[model samples]
Target: MSLLFENAIGDFELSTATLYSPTNGDLEATRDEPVPIDGIVEYASYHDRLDHPEKDDWIAVPLHESDSAALTGEYIAFTDHALHGEIFVYDDGDDYESIDRDAFVESTLAERVRFWHSDYAPDDPPSYFDSPIAEREPPRRPLSGDDAASFFDELESFVRAEMDAQRDANGEKAAGSTPEALREQGFGAIPSLSSLGQPEDGTYRFRIDDDGDDRAQDRHRYVQREFGIFEGNEVQLFPPNAERAPDAFPIAATVGSIEGRTVRLAVDWHAIEDRSTVGGYLRQKRRGYAVTLLLNSVPYDRELEAIARVRERDDHRALLTGETAVTFGDTAGVKSSQQDVELNQEQELAVSCALLADHLFCIHGPPGTGKTRTLVEVVRRSVQAGDDVLVCADSNQAVDNLVAGSSTAATADERSLHAYAQHGADEFVLRRVNAGNSSNDVVGERYATCDGRADVVAATNSSAATLDREFDVLVLDEATQATCTASCIPLARANKVVLAGDHKQLPPFSATEDPPESAAGMSLFEHLYADGGVYEGVGVQLRTQYRMHRDIAWFSNRRFYDRALRQGRDVASLADRPALVGYDVGGSEETIDHSKRNDAEARLVAHVVDELRTEAGLEAAEIGVITPYTAQVDAVRTKLTAQLERGREVTVDTIDSFQGSEKVAIVISLVRSNADGEVGFLDRPLDGPRRLNVAMTRAERFCALIGDWYTLRDSRGGAGDGTDLYDDLHSFLESTGRLRRVEPEFIPIPE
Candidate 1:
């Protein structure tokens, strides 16, 4: 949430109706999936054009229709430029008649886009069956490669013309040279790098997206796989040596062009018949290459049998044996925090579980429970005992947070006494720090080398996956937020694992399915926590929370945590804090808006923020507005930022944003207000408690909850079909006199 307001969406862009999207792909496909675009914009104006950005230039396709009709507009002359990536326009419809089919087949440029349709689906494949792409169909005819060569030529012309218009950019800054001479010079300077691998039977492609030549490859073969180095715009030919790579560069032809860091080029089959060209940068592409190998190279046969026996509790004989916790050395237990602070009972127990060499440990860290602190100490102690440690978290912030702690742990005390070994050949190069004083530098580009190597190798879960070295311990903080598969990535390199998270806060974040049925949605922490009391010693609960006041936490602790959590002693003065209160607001619910935002509720949240500041004597720093929905969060943020007075630093965010931090007063705006007791996604019977638990427990002096009590109290599914944990919370709050009904603030109509 902080990232949204501070770095991403501005106040106006946060309006419920504003659209958003991403336009980039991940460098490594196997390690990180490409980010998907979202919420379509209504139109692309001339200002959106890369070459001709004037209002009169781009011809609009249609107000509501698709871009396929762009050529029918008055600007048919500009269609050629758009076809070859030379200029941008309002729509991206292509001209299928312009492509040549035989040229495409000659290049083995087969495509699946036009070849198949969704005509093959199952009637019932059973509840557990989950296919990656859902369904498959027989092959169909693909597009042509004939038009692709012409498109690149047109693209070259577009690039030269745009350079002339933006005189200050590219080679245009000079006034001496004619546009023709500058274009020639610009085209000549396109950068090129050498290729790698001792010239095996490796094949590359000349893929121009939307061009008929863009083809799909057979994924079943490893050598035939395409890494897609440069935006996939590649070209190639066939020869006698195509059957196997030659020992030297065969007599070949190559074409190259450059625009900034990307060197756009095409090489013939002759060039790839040898590797005397690009080797260094090609080797750096090892990130995703290794991930693919690791995933496919699993010892399936042995691991499957071992897993079955272990699961049935019959024989624990053989799995991938090596660095089990029992074989790994034990810790001498020399650990300390940033300031050498003493650990509370809860922190002590959490750290003790990790040092005891348990195969698995579940550390329940509720809001402000110092979960990261305990995990840091565990890693430091284990490393001091002469064992390599890999600390991982699901998000980048959490990963950097742990590294910052370890950086402090290493520099603040006698951590320098131990000798450290860099994990692999490269020093954390998968999205790494450029240069800085410490590990925090690893984030956001400013970073330094490991001049001062910390005791542990820390990174986001997948980022550290390239390291195949065995480690003594792997601590996963905030484990419940990651899917079971994501959390297990560290287990592949560790003997023992520790899961530190509270499933009662937020489960795995899946944008697709609800209550994720796939293995990716099942969280490891959730599984171990709910697997019965057999996990007594392996699970340690951190009950003392420093975030909420005693009175503020009374209801949530008793109702959510089974009364196990306590307020820290240092904050004992706040024990007499006003009890957690709920204002029903008789908040009327609309018939569940599909847009997932409520402007009226957003204004009400701003109204609550104003009332608290003026009536309750609280500063903006003490107030926070929280919602469960992203759209609602955006809506409320827009209201507060645009309407609130200066110096009002009130933050508006979601549960994930406030997970590790807290404010004096937290106001929750339950966006769902349906009168039918349909609480939308937030009211899911199983996930309801996690959302409510984190929301209600983030307050220190005051907890203000504004929602439709009638609807939220139902504890049922979206359609009121099933019951859940919220039912019990509603009963407890009503019985204890903590619940009350109120009205939404009255806003006057404009004259």
Candidate 2:
């Protein structure tokens, strides 16, 4: 016997068969069948099994809880007839509880029971059943163009109506007032006049009375009359005073009858505070003594239009340069005393400025070579030439320095670099000049109305690239750090481009990589070499370390330069430089051991803090801790603050946050490799070359690195291994004279 089942949700059907064994109980199984069901009417036959051996067996049928309840007390019984099959029906038994009526009706069997039986007639034809559900379509969105246009049009109409109503309410009839009538009423110039008509030479005459009649008439009246030129028509006299009239006073005057043959007329004029004026008037008609009212109006629309155009152009230029236009007075309050220290690259700065003045040049200097100071001098010279200068740097600190210095040197009204480079500043047109904000064709139009037309524009390299017009001089700080792609735009836009940064520090992150042929490989100059070509361009090498002590500088230079010379690199030789000195650390490698206690890291941090606080007399804000790993940062932070009293404020930032930042003193904690030989630096992967490079370079004025110098030496295999990480760092120190081990100045903490 076969059975049918259906899934209500997806509406799929399953057919099954029952098998009987004389020894075992009845077994239920699935069968592939062409069965005639009640819901699906057709004459069909059932197959006992499929051809596959696995499918030829009967399996037990499992039912859900609700379906099992519906099957209680049901029995399968075979009929005597061949065409008829066994049937099962729900029945209450003594041992079995009655199948739950509610549960059975809500079960899947209750829905399947309706399809169990069908009238099996030989002439029956097949019929189909269709689902009641229907498909749906997605909703539509409204059009933006129509809505936007409608909004703006409505706004314009509303503004125009409001302005017209305001004018009318103020008694300003622009097109229909007379100047002669206004003056005849003894007013100097009617405050509501639109326009004043020129009066005829002798058509009107008047006599002024300083003391006519304060009570009966009014103060300062005028007497009107008709003269020989009167071709009489209706005339209206103002002030309406018959007592003030003279004998034989007529309605009009002739051309020669008036003194100097001139008549003064007044009209309705409106004076808007700090904005504009409007008025109306009355004048004599060409043919008669009678005067006709004439009106003249002055609207501020033209002036407002000019102002808007100027503002738009200024905004466009500001966006293009990443520099906002500002007025000099806005930054006058900033003090110059804040920047009192002289830069170490003073001579190099002068040379750079001279080069920028002479030609399009690049001032390639490494970190601490004072590129920022050099660019400032370049800006100063450009300002001296009466050229508008644009100064751009990669960070806000760089911009601040440029603005602070330039504003201090410039006059109150002179256009400073800040005014042209800061956002929202008055002259920030270059900052606004972007393709999205303005049309490319009209990009430079704003510069036409600049009060100091030859102003300087300063911004970062990214900002400079967006400018459409060429500047008098384009100075790029940290030029070596910029990729070739970033450099191309500014180089193309400037009349003179100055690339300032050191290639030795770090090349652009995006430059293509191809190993140089050899140490003696052809340089950029040699590759492009030709007879009488520009191959001998001068390169300036700065050989000074003003920030470090002479001994520290000497040790660092010895280690860094010797390796470069050994590698056959074109590094500068500083062996004979007298300013260099050697640091004697008592030859003790024992003090370099990793701290044992959790408090050891804290003590080390506290030591550095105490040194900065006592010896350098630095403020907390001027000090920063830069570590190679986040764990080490956490360790050092905990240690530094553990011993401090409550309510003390100190901040610790990661190397990522410290980038493009400067501090008076920086303490570097080099997190040691863990037991598994893992170390991280600057959030970069714990690789050899990168770790060594990053761990050595994050200092502005002072650095105190806490790491195992012994591990560094052991890793290098006696300092001669060419591939060793420490060897690389040692070589850099010798060449640059910027890093060296020394007896750090220690300050004891209070007990």
Candidate 3:
């Protein structure tokens, strides 16, 4: 039996131990054959029945101080425990496994409770185990003088080797490494640069870029390339303007592809390109942590204590909430006398919560409850108080929406009032910052760049965190869709944090089965909102919805929001029209296509949309199509685009994509048409209602639902049916004389 490459540190400790025929991974839980040890004895299993003091099945592997020959690492430990019983391993101590913080947090109480005896070979059985860790600080490897030099050296080597490998593969490098490639001989008046073009599968051609010959590129000359990746585009080339490039200058690329000159990236391109770039930041975050304990750079000492205060104990929740005295416009020493910026009760309360909040505040905003409008108040108030503000969201559109609302240029003569009237309301400052990975092209030229000294900076949360600047307030919009760990990036940069989002909207979709943890898949808004009311209340529930008709909104209001949703005057005017209408599309026994595409239902939705636009005298922009799947969204968009008039544009998107957005009328296509009554996650017990809630409320005037009534409404088929939302809404639709039936005109499924 041998132990090799052991790392004994705080939370992580790895070792390759062998109990059976030299296994490559973790130590065996049990052995086929036992070997004699010097003085090792197995204690009775901890769960062992008979009154054994140490009842666990774990056997402690002794620390052999006398025989240092067995271990090679400074942080290696010999006393390991093992036993492969239920959840935690417990037989032999011979395994190397990576710990998943998310998994640890999500694990059953029994799973976690059983974890201790296996990891910690305690001399005596302890009365209790500490709480599972949800977050940690970024790891710190304090650099020595040698370490700093080594970092540069390694960086240089990595850059050179990586570039060479690409150049060699692309047949671009000269016979001997150019002096320019190895080390530029001297500084050129201008740095020479080129651009990259994909000539072939494995070839990239470099062409000189004349930056009108920007003379600023003249200093250090070498061949260089900087690359950026945003939405839809895989790579963007910013060729150096210099006639020559530095032998080694920073390139804004995850994997350098030099077609340009020197590039001092705005943010760490590596972090954007590959989240797992050198540091364990991403990994720690995935495991449910801010990594606040790892490095102090990101977290202030007070922040560190605050983290512990919230996470280490529940007592702080009560204390923090009890002491919080929130009042709107009270955060800043100066209160705005501008009556033009008056807020509604919920909006004012949300701003007050943010103002009075010492650490955190949550705003529970259902769709169309004016989350963005409330956010505008917070930003203007912050700016009026002379505080730097960073507003962030999960999506680029969400951030842009916030930016448009706060910036004087976008909302100039509109409803929103600017804070700094000194520059006039039409010219108050704002910056629309985006992650380098953002596809700003779709957002128009204004998104490409903005003035740096704007009163408010709106950015994708991750990009906002790398800004190399600080802010007094951090407001995360659409916060429910971001992981708590990722949310910490922006949160750490500000003293106070405010969150706005509806938990019932889309939960974050993760590729990996193991999700990040905090309060268990509940977003930051959800976590704070859950405990806030118990004390003095750290959040204001946005209850006035202006997007959906009173009757159309009734289902979600009664079910999701406890019937507190009030329709604004605009929505109330829609009462004369039918709020909800249903169309049955499975007239022919045709099932949904293999890709979950309901062509028949999709066509009916488009047909209904055209009818609404022409007969109701509504513009195409007034209509929205909501579906459960992406395939259906595309299908509907294609169909609707073909049917609508040349200048008329309609909004078509998946249910999740339509959240935080609204249109006057909504056309929903329920794609699932199965004989077996498969509902396709729409009736997924818990998620079904939430998804349906968002789908139902995006309309202001009329809502037309098209689908298989048998699949949704009558699947269980009884008066007291144990059916779903569709069944309940189906009866309601009947009472309102809004139900219609349509036959399917089947289309071939795409390959």
For this target, which candidate reaches the highest TM-score against the unseen true structure?
3
**Poorly placed runs, candidate 2 (over 4 Å):** 1-359, 366-368, 405-454, 509-538, 559-603, 614-617, 638-662, 675-702, 716-751
Q: What is the TM-score of each candidate against the true structure?
A: 0.52, 0.37, 0.55
lDDT by residue (tens digit), candidate 1, 1-751? 0111111111112112211111133111222321111101111111133123333433221110111111111221123244453221322244212212222222211111111112212343323332211222111211124432232233233333332333223222222333234334432121122232232234322222121222332223211222222222222211223234334322223224322222233334444533543332233322111100001112122223323333333111111111111111122332322222577876875675466432566788877677777776676567655666777787766666655433432342222111122322222221222212133532333222344544466656655565646667778887888765456466656767778887777777653435554333557666444333112334668888876667667767877788887767645322333446666655444333343665666776787677677777778988888888777776777788778773237877887677655777888887666656766667565576667778887777777777666666664444653235555666766787877665455632110
lDDT of each residue in 410-451, candidate 2, tens digit only: 332122233333221443333322222222222223322334
What TM-score should be assigned to candidate 1? 0.52
Poorest stretch of ten by lDDT in candidate 2: 326-335
Worst 10 residues of 1 by lDDT: 287-296
Question: Candidate 1 deviates by what RMSD?
Answer: 32.0
Query: Tens-digit lDDT track for model 3 on 560-676?
Result: 788888876555423345777788778322333334677787778777777776678777777788888877777777776666674237888888788767778888887877666
Candidate 2, residue 106: Cα displacement in angstroms equals 99
| Residue 197 of model 2, lDDT score | 36
Please rank every candidate by lDDT, starting with the best.
3, 1, 2
- Residue 328 of candidate 2: its Cα lDDT? 11
